[model samples]
Target: MSVRSGDKKTKILNPITIEKDFGGPIGAAFLTIFLPLTTIFLHLCCNEKYLAQGLSLEFNKVKDLFYDEVIVNFKENFFNERIWLVYCSWFFILVFLDFILPGKHLKGVELRDGTKLSYKINGLAMMGLLASTLIARFIQTNGEMPELSFIYDNILSLLCTSIFFSILLSCFVYICSYLPLMMSKNGINTNERILAAGGNSGNVIFDWFMGRELNPRILTWDIKLYCELRPGMLLWLLINISCLHKHYIETGGKLNQSLLLVNLLQGFYIVDGVLNEEGCLSMIDITTDGFGFMLAFGDLTWVPFTYSLQSRYLVLNPIQIGWLNFSLIILLNILGYYVFHSSNSQKANFRKDPASFNQMKSIKTKTGTLLLCDGWWKLSQHINYFGDWIMSWSWCLPTGFNTPLTYFYVIYFGFLLLHRQKRDEDKCRKKYGESWKEYERKVPYKIIPYIY
Candidate 1:
């Protein structure tokens, strides 16, 4: 019931209440199959060869989804050992950086046992070192980048590798969750293993999909936190940069404005994510959700592959943008970034030291937590989501209106943010009860101002 930490004992909550999320077992099963297939389908749909043969969402072009050349290429390249080696090497390098990197060890939110886990905040440094190594290699080769297009060429294989790794990791952690506490000698504290509230449904499929262990770790290396940012986020930026280089080489050193915008905006987003990595410690993924198949696949495969679709799209369809359009998109992203960053900072600061935000109005709940009600929080319950959605458009708008496929990121991100907001509201309502209702009364809009 309690664990000793320092001079005091911390009480641990018991029998975490099981709550069926994502429509329970059937939905989990559906998503487990549907998501990966969707990623593959989207990749095929956006394939250069398929697009060259008039790939569109039209009924007649639907058959193009099964284009012979594309299918053959994917099948042939799906199991490239070289690609797998590069992907695995990248992962292990990140792990090495995580272990050896010097950083401020920030304590994460207290767990059910009322003990905090220390996390190394060195993502920015890691990014810098990786970028420096890459740049040094580029300089050494006189800017003759090592077949950067190989990434684009072997993308399918890379994706398969990530998906396989995610599945393998999920299985490993799930099995380890069943190990005895004596396994702590091997650096796993099975006694501290707790089933996720939404994942302990007694159904293996759903549990695996949703993640069985709440905080599966090896010694001090928190697997969930490490994966959340290191591999996927960095890989996303790397892919975007590689796409830019691919475009450069293919276009004979001519830079596409649209591609540049996509790279710059997304680069900024990724850089910000890495620099402010500590902000994610309190997010739902790290604080609540288990490191399951959903997160594993999302972090490894979905994020790097799907989120970089615009950059990948522009590699084949390099659309030119006017100065007017470019300026507007930049302004839009700046606005979005401002709101997203400031609001998050306010919330984080408020959570850490509510008294520091004395000027900002907040509603105190019976649960002894303060819900911010002023500043950006007054505009919407999830103003950060609104900002994030706004920025998603900037990433897509540069691809032009030639095909709806390029806009998939914005569309999918919008839905994902909306779902996340709804989930957050539901959880807060259940946690705070009438106080949440009061907070809602003070801040009516869910995400957008004067809108939904």
Candidate 2:
């Protein structure tokens, strides 16, 4: 087939054509080695143990009968657990709907530019996993919290087993999700091709502002490892911190300080992360990877990172509140969001339409105007790093000044950006060589303007 640009009819391969078989034992081997190794590394650093009991319980089927009851207990303990469950349920439903329903896959359909998910298939896959999870939970627990037995006796072990199976199930369903697209095209596979899907389906306001252009696929770093590691790492850290905080609170009874501000900020950060799936996928690391990579990163890394910390911490004790200071907390939280969101928006827009920029200003230096500096870019070639730092700082606000330890994320991010900037600079120097030299002549500082 052919597509027209001007006078030329460009030969276009079927967008869904799978001419080569990339998924095989080799790919599966690669995924297994990558996920578990990274998880183990994180476990070691966090001082977390993959309890043998937990590993054993993960496979026991007797645990499946008591899952619903356990979740009920979970709700009694967590308060808002029911609402959370409902929300999760809805999400799985939506993903499944997109997978099964015609025109919902976000591939080939051209009414909008949303990223594809098999709503129909995703739903079935998720439901199957959820059912299996419940069954595993029930059979393992059997409506009783027996005294801590061993891997064969613990809920956590059962959960681990459930997640292992769930991951396998999700991958199976995900593969099946693509089969329809494949069969429709007579066994053609087209994962790499850019095919328009869901025409003009975005929100009216968003459509006007952003248009239907797909996000650019650019690789500034090898962030696949980072993405895979980040979620699991985050979860584990949260669990450890929770454990620490619980110990502190239990020992001291109640304190004279409040943490409302910090908790709110953390909530916002998490919600924002979920809402920006497209932006997340826009990152070069995700686009460069195939389905196997996605499964490894999303399941092993992200899921564990986000959950482990809170689970560990909450089990230890409760978050105590002291004095409430609402005003200052709100303002700082807002400032943090402004910095983080604004900088990201600027970069996205700039990449889409660099010519939309009105001014072509340059900074003057001993070497002449050179190539660096001007506007926000002049303030910091990597303004987004500053924004990210601010957000991380705000999220840690709830912890207060008891210890600088709570602010680990911000500190870690600062170091990360510095390293990334240096790497980027080195790459630029190599790629552009002399031109990069000229650009740097105009802008000297790395992150903070005039300060760093």
Candidate 3:
């Protein structure tokens, strides 16, 4: 292992570590229910579906609403077996493509246990396939595009299927993680188990939520990595496309300008992520976060259903996008993408060859070394986070200054990134000690350049 500089402290909680940041089992239980419920409710808010006409939120009728409205509505609208079969078929085909498609077999960053995992680089090819499939299907229908609208129409059932499958997949992850240990003739060094890097935390609810295995797998396939990219991202684009189709059909082929901007920006982002698929190796999700329910659900359901909320809303709401406003949003996304790509590339290049980043210097710790503050990293501990923020809001903005709902993604993302920044800082402080403190002093801002 290459020696890297660090200081003192406790590190971030591993997923398999029995730490209760969400309060405890009760809290996790609530989240387990709440997150999926919120996923449904948000879709409800965007679509305003299944609500009785003239019904309102009232404290006096809160209990009645819970029993009659929430429970009954969810029960009825939740799952449709036909939709489930179709969606699952779509998903497995993507998996088949991921397996069959060829690309570089890249190695990931070394793990705490010294394992360097491998992942396939077929995302870009899969993305091309996704586009081609959609085009071919639509063209076959003579551009009527009902299949596209089918998703927008039956979104609730689709969400149910994704969430169900995510939970099922997490169960599979938990089981697979322990198979090696249970099967071993010798009392297995549990730590050396295949794909279960960090092992189980022993709390089922927490394990299910946070993930038990560090990098779960199936035969030769990298389950976590494949999930991290394939289904949700292409599904996100597909949902946006469906929204576009719905808009076109509604307005006699006139596209909603706001919807167009949202698609272009998010479409660009997804395509970039796929094309730069190899970079997933060094991402926090790949390196650290476990393959559990939190991620499984998020990658499959939350991402596809919630992340495209604005696009979904715009389909129903159809907001105006003026030329000036569109120009501003375009600029914001461009700037954000530029900073995000440039800052990440800068750090990645420095890691590969510090000499390439001429301004980089080394700080020697008692054991080894760490990179000196330079470029965007010098500006802020997580400068690219700000860039990411800019891009997120720009996508949200075309919804205009109407409902607070449209702005939710930006608001949620800001808080999420802030939590991530602190997590990274804590991890660095534990690893780098006083040197991390010094670097923190040098890079005072946590994300934004002047204002954190």
Q: lDDT for model 3, on a 0 to 1 scale?
A: 0.76
Candidate 2 similarity to native, TM-score: 0.47
In candidate 1, position 378 carries an lDDT of: 97
* Candidate 1: Cα lDDT at 218: 82
* Highest lDDT model number: 1
* Per-model tally of clashing residue pairs: 0, 61, 8
1 against 3, candidate with superior TM-score: 1
Q: Please provide, for model 2 over 1-452, each residue's C-alpha lDDT reduced to its tens digit, 9 standing for 90 to 100.
A: 21323234443422322222223334444654565444433222222232212223342331342343334454442334433353245334544443343321212122111223221112234334534654575468762312222211122333333334435533543333223332222223333323212111222222111111221112211122223323333333333334434444445634323333443455446445533434644543343223333344454443544234222322322344334545565666677677667767766666556557546554333433234246566677677667677666655555444334344456656886887687567655766666666667666667777777
What local lDDT score does residue 380 receive in model 2, on the 0 to 100 scale?
70
Write the residue-wise lDDT of candidate 1 on 139-172 in tens digits: 8977657746677777777877788888899999
Best by TM-score: 1
Pick the winner on TM-score between candidates 1 and 2.
1
Instruction: Write one digit per residue (lDDT tens) for candidate 3, span 64-132.
Output: 544554467655455666787788888898888888887888888865534466778977677777788
After superposition, the stretches of candidate 3 with alpha carbons farther than 4 Å from their true spots are 1-19, 48-70, 73-76, 181-191, 194-199, 365-369
